[model samples]
Target: MEPLAARTIPDLVRAGAVHFRDREAIVDGAVRLTYAQLGEEVNRFAAALAARGVGKGDRVALWAPNSWRWIVAALGIVTAGGVLVPLNTRFKGAEAGYILRRGGARLLLVEDGFLGNRYVESLTAAAETHESGTSDLPDIVTFDQWEEFVGGGAASGGAAGPDVTVTPDDLSDLFFTSGTTGQPKGAMLTHRQSTELYVTWSALAGLVEGDRYLLVNPCFNTFGYKAGVIACLLRGATVVPQAVFDVRETLEVVQRERITVLPGPPTLYTSMLDHPDRTRFDLSSLRVAVTGATTVPVVMIERLRDELKLRTVLTAYGLTESCGTATMCRPDDDPHTVATTCGTALPGVEVRVDGHTGEVLVRGYNVMRGYFEDPRATADAIDADGWLHTGDVGVLDERGYLRITDRLKDMFIVGGFNAYPAEIEQVLARHPAVAEVAVVGTPDERLGEVARAFVVTRGPADPGELTAYCKERLANYKVPREFVFVPELPRNASGKVLKTTLRSR
Candidate 1:
């Protein structure tokens, strides 16, 4: 496998520009930029940021949906020696505002509109109400003003080189975790750690020169940012930026672009295979598929190979703390191994399970520096020994493959989106009618698991009313799909709510 020459994300972009100058780097709708062109744009963005007083160690947030512009903004921030704080696209205004404020971003790049929502307007309003008043908040730059923003820097005629010195250990990205308990905390990762992880990921995914990648996953997530875009840059793969995951649109892109790589949760591939019009699109170009946010059905693995005819169907296991790559299935592994286990650790990573509780623990260079500005939380996550206590219950088989059995934390994934019961319960508890509540993940046919709330109300309560209350505060996925109004919650002798009983009900 070819090795990376650059240590930082900025240097990586420059390396790609030098080696794959004329090669197409990104494709978003009508916009297509070659590596050289992308490099130029990134330089201009870096200059623009410098003009705005964004310097080393400053945080810049990207709130827009997936697009070529998003990739440019991310690289540009890193190039300018700024930490990229990516906001989730599905986040409600308050949710987005919390991340922006907590990360202390000095600049924000957001889309004016997306899927009928006025993102800029909502975020602007939310920012005003945020504890870190909008007065000191990041300058919100809309997508329509993108050209002007870029032009302002060009007109200034500032030097293309970075204004401040950048080191490998300098904070590159501050990814906020959607925690199972309490509010989100920013997980800090350095440039060296991120670049190293994705380079390994690219090789594991079998990415190579001239391959076309259909990136259906959100660019904000590690799956899209690191494995999707950065991995492509490392191996000269072309990226087709997808805003949302629509089966028809995905199939069209694959057939039209001859997309060689498509990686997402199992929901993506299953939707394609189950779609009635699946055969209408020529899917022969699909070569690599990397999946696994939740459980992987054995049949899903079988169909990816037998039905889709994909050469490589890899299942990976990771969390944001681990830079999103801890273990991954190999290309040559059998379907059963791929289906049953989240393969062995990468070359330099170590994986062990707690002998008593069976919680997976990972120790590696890929681990994040710590939770930004929250050393207490950081110490809780990474113990004294340097192993990241991955709060996940799993077992290492004789062959060293890991099969995750359960999550020690009260977090569950709904349609690949994590829904923490504590977070949801916190939102629900705010309703005047709710006296007490216990939320749990109940099995679902479509989405792997969805939130189910059992509420003990002070007065007469309506599930619809409570649902709408949560919608106002939380993302749509976090809103409980099914609400059970009960007199009291089942509890243990210690007075802790027995979530297992709630799930059994």
Candidate 2:
């Protein structure tokens, strides 16, 4: 194994080439890339980008589904000394344009079409519309075009570009927050930060060689991209990428591939648990399951262990600003602890609860370098003492486990009483008919603000009955003032409910 200081992304690929040369690195149905083949592809892509004038400090964006190309592109960009900017594939034209322009991307790689949508055509239209006369518009390249560009220059002796020396502190990836409250800002992650996060998470999760990882979540999200894909690569584990989430198909893949590790949001676990064909698949091979992006309901965790037969069901907590994952429950944690706590901070990281407001603050190599081109916001987020203020209200238990109560901004003052959305959401999630729920503070003439819940129900249920159920457990002021039933809550690509969108509606 390479030393941590010497283990760069490119180094990981090179090591895998020698250790697991012919072993499967990534599998996407009919497509499979051996470690050696993937390493060669990474080198070729890196050379192609360097030939196109992409160098150190340049930003390259990848907007596509979960595929072999995504991994190759990310590794290529990093190896070429360029910063990688992964865009959410579900972003609309406006959102995509904003990210591209904000990041000042020199190049954009995307799929021709996915899920029947012409992403390349749509992105071109968006670019033309947004930057009609701009000189720094990004150069668009299709997947096949990119492959040809690299393959075309094979005999030119340019496939092996000049090796650029980079330090552990050099920026490698810029992940933008999901921006549930405000506009997104890029969180800069150094090579050391990225590598440390993956290494620590893999140790905490007990991931090892030959582990088959089923990756259904969007790789654009750091949780899935770094913790799942990157971690698996470092461990010589087989990565099975899913283009999109389909419960039945996911189950089938798990059985067919003998997938051992499954990491996704709680909503995904719920969907898999509720799938009618779930019992038909042989899921005994699955040993580890991780849930993040939102709080995991205790009932859901119980069902995951009892019914799904996954022995280790862990809950993780982190943000884009944390380089992916900062804290997560270990495999040996009790079920109740796993459900209630986000686990202790990973090794070499320090987590502290604010003395006054109980806001979670983290300081470590995993913390980001700050938001790109947003010094004021960065200053507000990271304190002068170098601790990244997470803005999440939490409490550290006696055992050093951190339990997130709610987002500080999401907590509201109702009739001069504080009401936390997570507390209310947890209570509502326990209701028999509630499938999904999001609580937001809406304007109230009497009180300064009141809680309003958007709920997705599994069956017929009256709002009055739900209110009565909450009143029994929660304080009168903390109970939701109104309930709005919906088919489903608005969620981002990672399956986190967008409370900001719910509030707007």
Candidate 3:
């Protein structure tokens, strides 16, 4: 067995075959690949990429839906010593083009059409209109075409490519955060940083060989790709990929595959909880169910464990700048703690609360190298002392648990009183008629600044009634002065609420 320290992303894939050759590595409907088979595909894809002028330090963009092909492409890109840049599948031409140009992508591999969106058409247009002088006009290839280019017709007897040696210091990926405040900047993650995070998360979650991981989140996001796909490879676990999320279909897949691990955002759990035929599906095999990207409602956590029969429910917190997961609720944590806290920092990571304002600062191997080609932003995020100021205001309880109060930038001062959106959002989520809420500070002459809430209601509830409900529990200044009812909160591709968008209105 290869030493975990010596393991790169490619090494992890090969190690899975040596340890669990017969175990399934990926299952997508009728398509199932064992560890050994998946390793072969990864190697072939590497050779294909190398043959097309992709080599050490080149950036290969993967703009596709979640599938076995996406995994193969990601591993292949890394194996060929190329930096994998996974773009959001939900991106339109303008957004996708910006990412491609920003990353200086040389090659883009995409699906034909996913979820009624013509991905191939969008990529083609983006490639043509890309205006970055530093970036090459990327070559576009459909997933089918790339497969054929590698070895669809000819016998698979091509000479094995030379080993692409990568040190821990080599950049592995460039993941862009879902720019809520400004333009998105790419977070540079080195091989060692990514591997360290994978190891820490695998150990913390108790993942093992033969575990079937059901992944529903978009692969473009660091949380989904690194935490789900990369972590599974490190632990020799199988991945059940979903091209798109459908509550009914997800339940069916879990039953049919005997899935052991399920990790996604809270919205997914809410959808599953609301499914009328949820009981009809045999979800007894589920061992660990994890949720993140937002606070998990206490009711949702309890129902998932008691009614859904999941053995454990965990919650995590992190960002693209922190290599996916920094803190994760322990398996043994009580339901109350999991609902309130984002958990402690993982091993090999250090987190501290700023003395003056209580902003969270993280320093560790899991932290990104920096924002790519943006020294100004990088300086603002990671100081000269090497600490990545996480901009999130949090505190460590006496028990060593970390409770995120709110984002420091998101905190609003209303009439000399502090207003944290997370606090108000948590209170609003408890309302029976409210599905979701986002609060932001808007300009006001009298109070200097006032809290305004945007809400998604479960039923036809009046905004004024909701405002009055808040006034009962919170101080007059803490309560939202204005409430706007919307069908949904504006969110980025990764399911994070876009406070900038809310503030813009």
* Best candidate, lDDT: 1
- lDDT at position 321, candidate 2: 88
Candidate 3 global lDDT: 0.78
Worst 10 residues of 1 by lDDT: 129-138
lDDT of 2 at 445: 49
**Model 2 residue pairs with clashes:** none
Taking every candidate in turn, the Cα RMSD to the unseen true structure, in Å, is 1.8, 10.5, 10.4
Give one digit per residue, the lDDT tens place, for model 1 in 363-461.
999998899888988998999989998889999988889999988898898887777888888878878999999999988877889999999999988
Residue 226, candidate 1: Cα error in Å is 0.3
Clashes of each: 0, 0, 0
- Between 2 and 3, whose lDDT is larger? 2
TM-score head-to-head 1 vs 2, winner: 1
Ranking by TM-score: 1, 2, 3
**How well does candidate 2 match the true structure in TM-score terms?**
0.80
Q: In candidate 3, what residue range of length 10 has the lowest lDDT sum?
A: 153-162
Clashes of 2: 0
Badly placed stretches (over 4 Å) of model 1 are 1-3, 127-136, 156-161
lDDT of 2 at 231: 90
**Ranking according to lDDT, highest score first:** 1, 2, 3
- Report the C-alpha lDDT of model 2 over 1-505, residue by residue, as the tens digit: 5423335777777778778788899998898899888888888888788777788889999988898888888988898889999987765544566677778889988876766656666556656665212323588887868668787446534456436765667888888763334356899988877776787788778788889999887788887788877798778889999988888889899999999999876767887888888888899999888876555678888898899788788988887788877788988888889988999988888899987448899998888899999898899889998999887889998888988876766766564334568767877898999998899988764454688999999999899999998865454676898999999888899998788898787
